[model samples]
Target: MDDQLAFRADDQPSSTSPPVWRVLAVDDDVDFQRATAFALSELDLLGGRIELLQAFSCREAALLLARERDIALVLLDVVMETEDAGLRLIKALREVIGNSETRVVLLTGEPGRAPAHEVMRDYDINDYWTKSELSAERLLTVLTAAVRGYAQLKTVASARRGLQMIVESSNALFCSKNTRELSSKILSEIAVLLNLQAEGIVCVRAEEGEGGVAKARIISASGRFRPSVDASLDSLDSPEVAAVLRRSLQGQQTLCLSDCTVLFFPRFQAGADYACYVATERVLDDTELELLKVFSASISRGLYNVALFSRLEEMAYQDDLLKIPNRNALIRMLDMTLKDESKAERVLVLIDIDNFSGANTAFGTGYGDFILGLVAKRLCDAFDGNVLIARVRDDLFAILGPQTQVRAADIVALFRRQTRPYELGQVHSLSSVTMNLGDFTGSAGVALQDALLTLKQAKRAGHDQHAVYDSRLLGAHAEAYRMLLALRDAVEAGHISVQLQPQIDLQTRRVTGVEALARWRKADGSMVPPLSFIPLAEATGYILPLGDLLMRLALQAAKELADAGYGDIRVAVNVSAPQLLQHDFIERFVAHLQAAGVRPQQVEVEITESVAMRTFDTVCEKLRALREMGVNVAIDDFGTGFSSLSYLRLLPADRLKIDRSFVLEIGQVSNEQMIAEAVIQIAARVGMQVIAEGVETRQQADWILEHGCREAQGYLFAKAMGCSDLLRWLADWPRDRA
Candidate 1:
C-alpha cells in the first residue's frame, strides 16, 4: 500500500491537463472501494487524468450511469447487497438504457456467486475478475485498455452524428428557394454540424473589386453576431471575425483559427458566392475538419440549385430586351393591385409609335432600339414615382399610374411637350415624334388586353390621339377578329372571287388588258367590302395566301383569254409586298404561270409604290426577274405613295398607273389636271407608259388623253365584272362603242 501510494504521487499530472477518463465503481465493501480508488489514482496514462465516481449500491450505480452518459468504464461488484445485482445492473445499462459503447468490468468476492459465461455474455460485460485474485497491475491494465476502447468508440459515434447532421442540413437547406433563406440555414447548420457554442456569420462577396480587401456583405449571423445579419463584413465589431471572413472570401478556401474556423464556398459554376465564419472555443481535429469539408460541399451544391432556380424565375417574369417587367410580371402586379380594394382608381395607358416600321426603314434597327429606349424613359418620367412603366413591344410601351396622373388631357400634353431634337449619326435631326395612346380606367382583370384593343382603334383613328377603352371596343375587336378568321376561311374555300376591269386603248377604243380585283363572298351570300377586309388581310399576313390565290386565278383567266382570241390582251395582277418578299416567290409564281400554260407576256405584275419603298432591294430584284421572264411590271397607284420621284429611275417598270385620287376630279380642278400631266411627263421621260385610273367621265378621259396618257381604266370604259361578263363585253365591244 505504501509503494502504491508512492507510485500514484509520482505519476500524478498537472491540474491544467484535460480529463481523459471517467470511471465508475460500485460496491458495498468500503475497504475494497477505498483500495480501488487509490489504485486508479496511482496509475497515469501519460498526462491523461481519471475521474472516479462511487456507488455503494446497485440503485446508486444505475443512477450514476444514467446521469453520466459519457462514462468510459464501470467496475462492478458481483455481490453488492444482493447476488447477481451487478449483472442485473449491467443488463439495465445495456438493454434498457442502451449505453452500448461504455465498457463494464465485474469484480466478485465469490466466483461461484457470479453468473456463468453465457450469462456474462448475455449481460455484455467486458471482463470478470475475482477480488481476491485481482492485482494493482492487472487493474491498471484493464482500465487502460477499456478507457482506450471507449475513447475510440466515442470518436466514431461523434463522426456518425456529424454525418447525420450534414445530411439533414442538406435536405433542409436545399429546400430553400432563394438566397436569403439558404444563407440563414447555412450559418445555423455550421454551428450544429460542428457542435459550436460561439457566434458565427455567413457572408457573400457581392461585387468584383481590384484589391484583395473585397467588400463582403453578411447574409446571416448567430449568437452574439445576430444583429450583424445583412450588414457589411467591414462593419463587424470583432476584428478577428472580419479578418477571417475577408480571408475566406478572398482566398476562396477554408481557414482555421485558434478560436474560430472560416470556410469558403465558392460560386458553384455561376451561382451565388458565399462564405461562413464559425467562432468556437472547441478545437477541431482532423476528423471534424474533413467532415466540415464534406458539409460545405453539400451546402455549395444546394446554394447553386437555389441560385439557378431564382435566375430562372427572374427570366420568366422579366423582359429580356427591355430589361423591365414583362407581360407575366405585369400580370402579377395587376393581380396584387386589383385584389386590394383600397387603391381602386388605378389606370393603365398603352402607347404605340405611329409608323414605327417606317422609322426603322428610314433609319436602322439600332436607331429603332434607341427610339424605343427613349420612349421607355419618357413614359417613366411622365408617370413619376411608384408607377410602373414597361416596354411591351418593339414599338409599344405600357404605363400604369393613378388616374389623376394619366388622364386624357395629360396624355395629350405628354405627346405635345416640346422635346429636343435627336441626332442621327451626327447628321440628321428628328425634332418630334408622334404616338397613339390607349387608356383604361382600372387595374382590374384583362386590362392590358383592353388597352391593346383601344390602342389599335386609336391607330386606326389616326396618329397623335388617345382612345379610351369601353365595352364597345371589345365587341368591335371581336368582330374584327371574326372577320379576319372568316376571310382566311374564304381564301381557303375558294370563296374569294375575282372581277376584271378592262384597260382600254383610248385612241382605238379597244381593250388593251384587264386588271384583276379580289372580292370576299361570305358563306351567307353577303359581300365584304374590299376596303374593310383588304387592310385586315395585310395586317394579319393573310395577304400572302390571298395574293397567291388571286395570282393563280388571274393567270388561268389570262390563258383562257389568249385561247379565246384575246391574245393581244394582258392580265394585270396586284402583288403585295409580303408576297413578293416571300422565299422562293419568283419560282412559285413561274410555276403557277406554267401550270396555267400562260405566256409571261400575257400576264402583267402590278405592285403599289409602297412595296417598292418598304422593301426596295427585294422588290427591285423581283421586278427585274419579272422583266427577264417577259412579264411587264407596272407600278399601281403610283402617285399615292413615296412622293419622291427618284425611285422612278431605279424602278424596273413598263408603265405608271396614276392613282385614282389624281384622276378622280381630273379637268374639274386645274391642279388635278396639271398634276396628272406632270406624272405623265415623268413616266415618258423614264421610257415608261402612262395609264390613267378612275376615269369616270368623258371629260376625265379626254383630259388624260390630252396629257399624253393613252391607256385608261374607269367606270367610263367599263366597271369590274366577272369573267363571263368581261368575255361577253369584249365580244360585243364594237356595238357597245356605237
Candidate 2:
C-alpha cells in the first residue's frame, strides 16, 4: 500500500518538475511499474493534480483504494494478482463507500490481455485506454469529460427532487377548507418545501367600517417574527409598510421586500372583494413560482366558495329589494326575543301608506319607489338605536321596539310626519303616509294578519290617518268586512233589489220617469243606503256585477211599466266607472235589454261626467254603440267633471243631468247659476235634453221649470222607494196632463 501511494505521487509531477496523470498503477512487474510511473508522471492529466498509486499486485491496490475515496481515476495492469481484482474494487466502492456517483477510468498495458472491448463492457469503469494510445492529452480529455458529466447529472437530479417537494406541498396547502387554516398550511408547506428561513400568511379584511378599512391578520408564522394575529395593518403606524400593504391589497399583485416576498391574491365572491397574502424570503425558481400561482388560484376559489355560502345563508333571511331582514328573519328575531327573559317588553308597530294607489297613479312607479325607500330610511334613522325596521311590502313596513319607549300614538305620529315632499329630479312629489298601531293589550293576542286588517280599515275610513287596534276596533273592522262579504254574496245571489226616484214634470204635475237605485235590506228589515255601500262595492270590484244586475232590473222594470199602462216613462240606471270601461259592456247591456223584451228607447243608461271624462274615447265609443242600438245615453252630473266644453258637444248623449252641487248653489252663488245655465244652453245647442237633478223645493223646481229644463228629479216628487211602495204612490198620484 505504501508503494502504491508513492507511485501515485510520482504519476502527477509538479509543473517545475514533470507532467503526470497521477493514475493508480497496480502492476506486479516492479521494473515495468517503476518505468511506467515515471513515464505517466510526465503526462500531466488533471493539470498534474493526479498522483499515481503503484500496488505491484491486486492486493496492494485494493488495500490502498480502500483507504482513499477521492481518487479520480484508476489504471490497473490486466496481469495482476487477480485479473478481475479492479472489478471487485468498483463493487466495493459502490457498496461500502457509496461512491457510485464518482467517475473511474481504466488503463491496460497489454491490448489483448484484458481485451479492451471486453473490459469496457464488463467493468463499471468509464473508459478503456491501451498503453500504446495512452497519451497525456488523451487521458486528460477523458478524465475531464467524465467529471463534467457527473456534475451535470447531480444538478439535474437535485432540481428534480426540489420540484417534486413543491408539488406535494402545494397539494397539501390547497386542500384546506378554512381560509386561515389554508393560509397557515400554505406558509408552513412553503417553508418546508423551499427550506425558507422565515414564512407567514397575512390575510386582509377590507370591509370593516364605513367606506371600508384595511385590516390584516397573520394566520401562520415561523421563525423569530411575531405573527400579526390581532394586530391590524391599518394600525401599523408605519406609513411605508401600510402603503405597501394597501397597494398589494388593492392591486392584488406580488410584492418583494428585502428579506420577504409576498404574493397577493384577490378573492372574489358574489362580486365582493377580499385578499389573501402568501409571503416568504426563500429564493424560488420557475417551478416554485408556477406551483405558488396554482396554489393561489386554489385559495382564491376556496375563499369564493366560503363567501358564496355565507351570502346564500344571508339571502335565506334577507329581503331582496330592501336588503332588510325578511319575514323569516323577523320571526327568528321575535323568537329569540321572546325566549330571553331579560327582553320581556316588546312593541310592534305596523306602518301603511294612505291612498298608496292614488299616489302610485299621480307620481309614477319610479317616484313611488323613491318614496318607499325614503320612508324606510326615516324609520331606520328615527329609531335605529331603539327599534328594528323592516319593509314587508311596497307600502307596508314593520317596526319592533321596546314597549317602554314605543307607543301607538308615537309610532303613528312618526310615520305620518315622515312623508315630507321629496324632489325627483326637478319634479316635487308628495306621499300621504299613514300607519296603524297595535299593542299587546293582553285582551287580544298580537297577530300579523290582525294588524294588517286594522291598517286596511284605517285606510278605508279616509287616508292620511291611523287606527289603533283595540277589541272594539277589531270587532268593528271584522263586522265591516263581514258586511262587505255579505253584500258581495247578495249581489252574486241576485238578492239585490232596486228602488226608483220619480222624475216629475212640474208643468204637467206627473211622473215622467224614475232613476233606478240600489237598496240593500238586511234580514232585520233595516235598509243599507246606496251612499253607504256603493263606494265599497266600487272599491272591491263588486260594482261590475252590481251594475249588470241593476241594468237588468231597470230594463225589466221599464218593460213591466210599459205593459202596465206606464209606457211613456223610462227607467234610468247609473253606471259606475269600472262598469262603463268594462270590455263589451255595451253589447252586454244591449243583450240584457233584448232578453228582457224591453225596447232600447224605454231604458236610459246614466254615466257620471267624471267616469266619462276619465275614459273619453272609450266612453264615446260605448255611447255611440248604445245610440246605435237605439238606447238613450245621458251624461249624468254635468258641470262637475272639470271637462272640456268641446267634449259636451262631441258626446253622443240623448240628455244631460245637472249635478246636485250646482243645483244646490244655483240661487246662492251667481257663478253657480251662470255655470248651470251655460251647461243647459250647451246641451240645448247640442240637441240634448237637459234634466235638472235634486229639485227639492218649489222655488228650485220653479226656477228649473222656468229655465226650460225638460225633466227634474228630486225628493219633492218622491224619494227612492221600493217597487211596491212606488206602485202604491203611483195609485195615489194625479193623472198626467201632458
Candidate 3:
C-alpha cells in the first residue's frame, strides 16, 4: 500500500521541537503487528515520538513506501505469504518506490526460512534477528540512528544542487557583454539558487567616493522590484532595502541578514563595486550562505576580465604620449563616419610641421618632442574640443570635423596669430574637399590618401602654406604610382634597350669607347624620357633588375662590336646606390659577362660619386674586387656629387667622366672652363683618365683639349644609336660635310 501521512510533526524545525521520523512495519501476522505497535508506539526515537505505520503484505508495504515522502525506516518479516515474499518487498521498495534513503531491518518469527548472516549480508538490511531478539530498547536505538543518517544525506543533496546552479549561472554571466546584462543575470540566478521569487535589484557604485552610496544606482531589477530599476540609492522607496545596499557597498564582506542577503563584489581596477540585494523571510542555513560567497567570488572574477578587456582597448588605440587618438583610431572613426549617410559636412584636415628635422637639431630631441605635445594641446583648444584630432606621425596631426569649423583659412589664421610665440615651426595645413554624400564611394584608406595628397602639395609650395583639396591637385603622385607598376612589368620582360654613344679621343678624333644608355619605347613607339622613369626606377628599387638587364645587353653589344673589328672596347653602364650596396653585385656582374660570352676587360662600371662617398670602406672593397677582375671603374657625374678629394684619391678608378653641366658651358662660361680644367688636372694628378661629357660644339671640344683632356662625348661626335647603326657611324667618322 502506498503510505499515507500516518503522522508528521515539525518537518522543518527551528530548534523549538525535535524532527519527526516516520517508520513502517510489514508483517502478515496480525498479532505480531499489534504487539509491535504496542512496543514502539510511544517510543521517542531520534528525539521525536515514532509514528508507526502498518503493512500486512509485501505488496501493501511497497504501496506504503511509494506514498510516503520521508519514510526513515522499514521493519520487515521474512516468511510472509511466501518464503521470499518479504525479500521481494525490499526490491519493490528500492526500485519501484525509489526509497533508497529509508533504512530496512529483517525481523522474522521463523529464523530458518532465511539465513540470519546471509539475509543481513546479501540484502540491503540494517539488521536480521528472530522475534525473540528484537526488544523495545534495541528497536528504539536502531530507529534513531537511521533517522539521523537520512537527515544528513538530504542536506548533502541540497548542497550539491546549489553548487550545480552556481556553475551553470557563472557560465551565462561570464559571457555577458556589459555590466547591465550581467546585473540582470546575477539577480535571476541567485533567486533560482535560493528557491525564492525572481525579485531583486543589482546596484553598483564607484569605490566609496564622497562617503556612503549616494551615487549608487540600481542597474537591474525584476518582479516586485522592477519599478525601482535605475533608481539611485538616495531615491529608493524602501528605507530598509536602501540601508542593506549601502552597508554592502561600503563593506568588503557579504551580509546575510535575518530577512535578506546582500552580496558584495569587491572593486577591481576599471570597474565599480556591485551589491546585489535579495529578500527572504528567514536566515539561510550555513550551506546556503557558503554557496553565496563562492558565487560572489566567481562573478567578481568575470567582472575583472571585462575590465581588462576595456583597458586593452585603450592601450591599442590611444597615443602613449600625446593622450589623443592614434592613426588606427582615426581610421576607425573615418570608417564609421563614412558608413553613416546621416553624418554632417565633415572634412579631414592634415597639419604638418615644415622643416621639422631642423627643429630637432636646433632644440634637442627631448625639447622637440615637448613642443609637439604642445602643438597637439593647442590644436585641441583651438578646435574647442569639437573635432577628433589624431597624432598620425611625430610631426603631423590630422583633424576630422565640420568643414566650416575646419576650413583652411581658419588654420592659416591660427598659425599666423601674433600671440603664438612658441616658434614651433612654419605649419602647413590642407583639408580634403567635401565629397558627395549621395554618390561618393571609397574606403577610409582612399579618403586618407586624398588628405595626404593635399598636404603634400601644400608643403611643396613653401612653409605656412594652406590649400583645399580638388580633383586636379597632386595628379602627378597618382600618375607616378601607376607608372611604377608599368615599369616593374617592363623590366621583368627585359623590354628596355641599350643605345651606344661614342666617346672620341679629342686630338686623334677617333672613337675609343661607348657609353651604354637605357632607353624605353612603349608599344605605340612613343619614347619615355630617361628623366621621367630613371629616378622612378631608382626610388622604387626596380633598379636591381634594371641594372642587371642593362649590363647583360651592354656586354652583348660589346661582343657584337668586337666581332666587327671594334676590338679593345669598353662600354660603360650606370649602377645606382642600391645596386652597389648589394652583397652579390660583384658576383652577379662577373656571372653576367661570363653568361654573355664577353670578357670582363670589355666592360666599364659607372657609379656616381655620391654613391661612392657613403660607406667608404664597403664601396672600396667592392670596387677593388671589380678592378682586380680586369673590369674598369669610372666615377660618373664627377663634379656634381660630394666632390670629396679623398674619394677621388682613394677610389681605384680608371677615369672621371666630367659631368655634362660643366662641359656644356665650357666655352660660354669662363668659370665652367676653369672647373673643367681643374677636373682635368686633378685626373692627371690622380693618375686617372679624363673624359669631358656633352661636347656639343668644336669650341667646347677645343676647350676640353686645350685644357689637356683628350676624351669628349657629345652631339659633336654622334648621338647614341643601336650597335648596328653605331658601326655604320664608326665607318663614316672624321667625314665632314661642312
Provide the RMSD of all predictions against the true structure, rounded to 1 decimal.
Answer: 32.6, 38.9, 32.2
Give lDDT per model, in order: 0.73, 0.63, 0.73
Winner by lDDT between candidate 2 and candidate 1:
1
Q: Name the best candidate (by lDDT).
A: 3
Best by TM-score: 3
Over the stretch 302-343, how does candidate 3's per-residue lDDT look in tens digits?
A: 666556544544545666678888776888988887888644
lDDT by residue for model 2 over 614-686, one digit each (tens)? 7689889988998887777888989876888788789888999988887787678775446677777888899
How many clashes show up per model?
Answer: 1, 10, 6
TM-score, structure 1 vs. true: 0.54
Kindly indicate the candidate among 2 and 3 with the higher TM-score: 3
Q: At residue 479, what lDDT does model 3 achieve?
A: 72
Candidate order by TM-score, decreasing, is 3, 1, 2
